[model samples]
Target: MGEGGKRKSRQEDAPAPPSHRILTADELGLLKVSEVPAGDKWEETAAKQRWGAPDKAQGITRLQVHCPDWSSDRCLVAAARTSGRVTLHAGSDGGDLGSFRAAPPASTSGRSDTSTNAVQALRFARPEGSQQLLIATATLGGHVSVHRCPVEAALSTALAGRVVQTWEEAARLQTIGDLQAMDVSSSGRYVAVGGEGHQLKVWDLEAAGGAAAAAAAGADGSTPKAGEPLFAGKAGKPSRSGLQDLAHVTALAFVPGQDDKQVLVGTAKHKLWLYDTRAGRKPQAELVWGEGRITTLQPQPDGSRIWVGNGRGHVEALDLRAAPAKLSMGHALKGVAGSIRALALHPSEPLIASVSLDRHLRVHHAIKRGSLAKLYLKQALTGVAWLPPLPPAPADGAREEEEEEEEEEQARAAAEEADGDAEEEEEQQQHNGRGARGKGKHAGRGKADGGSKPPAKKQDSKRRKQ
Candidate 1:
C-alpha cells in the first residue's frame, strides 16, 4: 500500500479526545441496567446456595423492639427463639448481641428442654420515670418471667439481664391453659395474658411490689401467690354449648393511649373484642374481623388504627373509629404467601415489616398497602421487628483524642512560658543591669501562643505614675 493510504487508515483508528466527545443523557446519569429477579418464581439455586440445613433450635419464634416513650429511635431487638432463649440483636444490622434462657432448666437433666420450653410471646416496656428497660418472656410451658436489660450489655455469649419478676400459670390459676398471647400496658405497670380456652388474666406488677414479693412467693423463682388479675373476662359465648370451640384468645393488645384502661382481644372464633376494664368484665363491643383465627394484633403509636394478621394469610388495617360494628371491613394488604406470624411498624417511616410461615420477610407501604420489598429468608420465619434507626454518633474517640492533644499542647506552652519568664527575670537582675521593679513590671507580658496575655496591672502602674 502507498504511504498516504496507510496514514489515512491510522488516522481513522485514533480516538477523539475529551474536548471532542459528547455524552448522551443516559450516559450522563451514570445509570446501569440490570435484570430483576423473575416475578414470583423461586430462585432454587440461589436459595440452596444461601441457606444450609434448617435447624428448629435456632428458629426465631417472636420479636419485640424496645421503645420507651421518651425515645422512639431505633433500639435493641429481643428475639424469642425455639430453644427457650431470648436473644438480643442490634437493631441497626440484626447482629446478635446476647441471649438469656427464658425457661428454667430441666430438673432431672440440668439443661433446658427445648421442645417444652419454646418461647411463645415476649414484650418490652419501661415504667414511668424509670430508666431501666424491661423484657417479659412467656414460654409454651406456662411460665413467664420479667427481666431488666441494661442498655450497654452487648456480649454475645453472656446472659443479657436478671429476672426481676416471675410467675407460673399453674401456680396462679389451675384452668388457664397454654399462654398464646401476652402484653404489657403503656405504663408498664400492668400485664395481660390470654390463651387457649376462656383464659384471660391481667396482673398488676406495681401492686405485687416488684421482685421482693416475687422472691418470697417461691424458692424456685416461681410466684406462689402472684396476685389475682385486675380484670378477668370470658372470651366466647356466655352459653356453655359453643364455649369449647369459640373461647380461645390468640392475640391481645393494650390500647396505645388508654394506659391499660382499654384492651383489644382477638379470639379464635374470628371475633375482635374491645374490653374496657373500668366499665365491666364483658367486652364493650364484638366485631367479626376475619374468616380465620386472629394470630396477631399490632396497634399504632397514636392508637388511631390497628394492624391485624390472621391464620389465613391476610393482613388488614382496621379503622378504630369505625370499629365495634357488626361487620367491619378493613383494607386488605396483599402479597403475603403464608400465614403471617408477626408484624412490626417502622420507627419513623410509614412502612411495616412482616415475617410469615412461608420463610419470607416482607416490607410494605403502610398507607398504600403496596409491596415495597419481599425476601425469601430460607428459614421458617416466625417473627420480625424493626429496630429504631441508631442515633448519630458523638464526635468522640479519635476526634476527642485530637481535641485533648491540642489542649495538652496549649497547657505545655503555658508552663514553658511561666518558666521562661522566671529565667528572664533572674537574668535581668544578674546580668542585664535592669532594676528589679522594671523587670517586675514585665511579669505580665508573655507570648499569646502560650495562652497568656499582658495584664492591666502594668498599665495601671504607669497611669498612677503619670
Candidate 2:
C-alpha cells in the first residue's frame, strides 16, 4: 500500500478531537432523560420502591393488622400463606417480626392436604376493655381457631424473625363444611361463621370460656368445649323473595351499627344480603348488584356505607339507607386492574388499602376518592385488615376539648360579625336617605334664593367623606 493511502486509513480510524465539549458543569434537570425507566419496563425500573420488592418474601396470601394500643400507629401485622404458615410483621415499616407454622386442629391431624385448608380468613378482634388481641383464622376444612397474642411479646420476636408464638388458643368454632368466610364484630362480642346450610352459626365469644354464668348453654345440647361456643345459633339465612339458589356466603361483615344486631353477607349469586340477628335469620334486605359474584365486603368507619369488591375487578361503595336495597356501582376506583382480592381501611387515617389479582397493593384516600399510595408486592394477597385506629390518647382528651371550645368561640365570633355587618348596612341606608332629603330641600331653597352657593360647606364635607 502507498503511504498516502495508509495515512487516509489511519485518519479514518483515529478518534476526532475537534468535536464540541461541555465547558461548564451539567445541570441536574438536563440529565432527566437518563434517569427515566424504559417505558416497556416501567415496573422493573422506578423511583418509589419504598417498601422494596415482594421478592424479599414468599407469596403473601393474607394479612391483618393488630393495634392493641390505640394511641400509637405501631402495630403488628399478621400475614398468612397457603403454605400453612402465619407470619407476624411490623405494620409501620413492613418488617418481619416472626413466622410460625400453623398447627392444624386436633381433628385434622391425619390429613396431608392441610395446606388446602389454608388461611381462608384472618381477623384481629379485641374484646371491649381487653388489652390482648384475638387472632381468628378460618381455613378450608372448617377449622376456626383463635389465639390470644400479646402485642409486645409477639413484636419482640422481631429479633428472631421466624420464631413461633407460644400463646394459647382463645376460641375455636368448628363447623361441618369448608369455612368459606367469617367476621368478628368490632366490639368482639360475636363470632359469625358461614359457609353451608341455611344460616350462619353465631357464637358468643365472651362466654366461650366454659363459664355457664356468662355463656348460656346451647339449645342443640352439645356440651361446650374449652374455647368452644357458649351458645351457637344460626345468624343468617337465605332470602326467599328473589336471589335464586343462594350458593355460598362469600364474605361477612358485622356492620358497626347503633347495636350489634346487623351483619352484612355477600352471596355467590351477586347479592349483598343484610341480616338482622335480632330478627329471624332470613335476610332483611338484599341488594342485587351486577353479575359478578361478590367476594369481599368492607364497612365504612361510621357504618354509613360499605365498600364491596367483586370477582370482576370492581370496587364500589354501597349506601345502606333503605331496605330491599340495590347498590349502584358509582365510585369504581381508578387504576385497579384485576379481580380485587382484599380491601382494608386505615384504622385512623382516612385511607383505604386494597389488593388484587394484579399483584398490587393500593392505598386510597377516602375523601379524595383516589388511589394515593400503591406498591407492587407481586403476591396474590387474599385478605387484609387494618388495626382499628387508636383511640385518642388520654393526654389528648384535654387538647380535643380545647379545640372544641375554640371552634365554638370561632362560630360565635362569626355570628357576631354577621350581626355587625347587618347593622352597618342599615345605618348606611338611613344616611343615604337623609342626604337625598337634604339635597331636595337645598335645591328648593336654591330655586327660592336664586343660583345658590354650592350646598352648605357641611354637605360638601360629608359628601367628600362619603
Candidate 3:
C-alpha cells in the first residue's frame, strides 16, 4: 500500500492514546463534610378526646430531596413517588409547609386512568433580583407548573400551604404522552421539557408573562407570543428527525461551558446527543456509553467537562475542552463503576456524589494528577444534595493533642504486631531444623550398622524383635 494509505490504516486500528497529564485533587479542592442526614416526614397525630389530648403518630419512608446549588442552605423541594405528591420544603433547614397535587392537563384528562399525576422533575429558577420560582412536571401527564415564592420561604414553610400559581395545559403540543424529564436553564430564561416524543420544547417564561397569562397563550401562540418561535424543538422537524431514533430520553441537561445555548439529551440506549438551540441543527456530537443505559448527564460549571452515568453503575467524565488530538479528549474518569442512578457535582469542591441501584452513594474526589478517591455510603442512596458549609467551631488544643497521641499509639501497636509475627516465624524455623537433624542422625546410624547385613538375617532379627 502507499505510505499515506498505510498510515491511515494504522491510525484507524490503533487504540486511543493514554492521557499524559495527571489531574490532582488539590486542583479540585477538598470536599469537606457538610451535612449528611435522612430525608423523611413525620407528623404527630393527637387523639381527639373529651378530656384527653390526642396520641402522637409517626410515619417513616424514604424520600427524594432536591437541593439545587451547594451554596444553598436549604433543599428547594422534596417528593415521594409512592405518595404521588410533591412537597415544597423551606431551605436546607426548613420543614415542609405546603404541597401540590400534580394533575393532568385538561386536554389530556380523557387519557388519564389515575386521579393524580406523579411528580417527575423539580427545579428552582432564580432570576436576577426576582423571587425564586419552583418548576415541576407531572409524570404520565402533560403539564408544567410554576410557583413563585420568596427565597426565605423555603426555609420557613411548606409549599402546600403557600398559594401556588398553576399553569394548566401550558404547552400546545397534544397527546404529549408523558413528561419524562425537564430542566431549567442556569440563566433562568428557558425551561426545557422532554417526553415520549422525539422533540424537546423550550418555554420562555418571561415572554409567556405569568402562569395565568402563559396558559392563555397555549400551544398555538394565539396571543402576543413571548418571542419568535415560542417553542422550538431540538430537531426542527417532527416526522423522521424526532427522538424516535435516539431511544427514550431519560435525562436532559444544559451544557455549562458552551458559549452557544446547548443541551444534552441522554437516552435509554446510552447515547448522548448534544443539540444547539441557536442553530436549530442536528446534534454536534454523539457519545455512546458502553456499560449500561445512561441515566443522567451533568456538565461541570466551566463546560470543560461532562459527567455521565449509566444503568450498569459507571460514571465517567469527558473533557470536552481537550484538543482533538489529545488522547484524553472525551475520556472517562478512572475508578468509577456501577449502575449510576443520579449524580450531583459539589458546588465549590472538586467532588461528585453519585447514587446507584446498588444503594451506594459514592463520593468521588478528583485528586491531583488524574487520580480519584472514593467514599461509599452505608446504604443505597437514591438522591444526594450538597448542604452549605456551616460556621467553624472554636479551636480545641487539648482535643487536637489527644487525637495526635492516639494516632501515635495506634502506629506503635501495628509495628509491635509486625515484629511479633517475624519472631514467631524464626522460632518455628529453628524448631523444624532441630527435628530434621535428629531424624537424619538416627537414619544414618541405622544404615551404617546394617550396611553388611543380608536381607534374610535382617528379616529374622526384625521378626524376633516383634
Better of 2 and 3 by TM-score: 2
Question: How close to the true structure is residue 316 of candidate 3, measured as C-alpha lDDT?
Answer: 75
Q: Tell me the whole-model lDDT of each prediction, alpha carbons only.
A: 0.62, 0.60, 0.52
Kindly indicate the candidate among 1 and 3 with the higher TM-score: 1
The TM-score measured for candidate 1 stands at 0.63
Name the candidate, 1 or 2, with the larger TM-score value: 1
Task: List TM-scores for all candidates, in order.
Answer: 0.63, 0.60, 0.56
Best first by lDDT, ranked: 1, 2, 3
lDDT of 3 by residue, 273-391 (tens): 66777755566566666746667777787887778887876677766664222213244555566677667776666767665666444456644313232444333344544444332
Off by over 4 Å in 3: 1-77, 80-84, 90-94, 104-112, 155-175, 207-211, 214-247, 257-260, 322-337, 367-380, 390-466
- In candidate 2, residue 200 scores what lDDT? 56
Order of candidate numbers by TM-score, starting with the best: 1, 2, 3
- Please identify which of the two predictions, 2 or 3, would achieve the higher lDDT against the true structure: 2
lDDT of 1 at 80: 74
Task: List where candidate 2 sits over 4 angstroms from the true fold.
Answer: 1-59, 68-73, 92-111, 151-165, 196-199, 211-243, 321-329, 373-377, 383-466
Model 1 alpha-carbon miss at residue 343, Å: 0.8
